[model samples]
Target: MKNQLEITLQNRKNLHAILEQTPNEDLLKIPQGFRNNIWWNIAHVVVTQQILVYKLSGLQMRVPEALVDKFKKGTVPDGTATDAEMKMVADFLLSTITWTKEDYEAGLFKNFNEYTTSAKVTLRNVQDAADFNLFHEGIHLGSIFAIRKML
Candidate 1:
């Protein structure tokens, strides 16, 4: 689990670098054939980790409810994000993962409500959610890479 946490933290750092380097306009642009922008994908990953690892574990999410509402599954990008909002998301990209590691180390996640993802994968525990989160983040990372190419 520690190894998984380390990989998640590193993945977030890489994602945060992309968010930091991208111009605000570019981050908000939704390319043709895509439903969301680079910023949305990045923020979605952050929102999702909280949902998968915290919410599903019968704990409150680390991020605000509004943020979770905005970026959670099935939500669109709304085509707007202020500079401060982007910075907040960027900050959470690392901080959330750090907190998750600490929380997991402390055994805060002793229960998880079983969930079957839209991808048809079932997560029966926090460990499962943590592992699944890696795959989820990878998909969005690929999306970011493809979107970067289009931009």
Candidate 2:
């Protein structure tokens, strides 16, 4: 099996492609407020990865605090994002994934915190964390796709 970082990188790439296929206007429409829009979901994934990799693993995360609230979990866009801002966040997410892979290979992750879920145990190391994150990303991706179909 590929390492956790590789799997996560692949998932990120796949998600980027999926997002690109979504029309820009469709990215902002949330169906019934049950789920966030495509853009919000994408941003959430980026924020989540940064939080887990940087805060949880003690790696560097350059994302600004001001921007963190904008993309942090449960923060939906109130139609406040300019086109430029949306694009910038998307670009930054892609870059962050690349940087994370480099750091992973360099052994920057030292923590091996076990992650438990009600369903099952998820991770036992950085590699495991990466795998779990990739799985989580898929869940987000599914939500995005389902929301797109609804909208």
lDDT string, candidate 1, 55-108, tens digits: 999998889999999999999999999888888998999999889988988989
* lDDT, candidates in the order shown: 0.94, 0.72
Per-candidate clashes come to: 0, 0
Candidate closest to the true structure, highest TM-score: 1
Candidate 1 residues lying further than 4 Å off, grouped into runs, are none
TM-score of 2: 0.80
Model 2 — which ten-residue stretch has the worst lDDT? 112-121
Q: What value does the lDDT take at residue 78 in candidate 2? A: 76
TM-score of model number 1 = 0.98
lDDT tens digits, residues 77-110, model 2? Answer: 7755677777767676678778887776777888
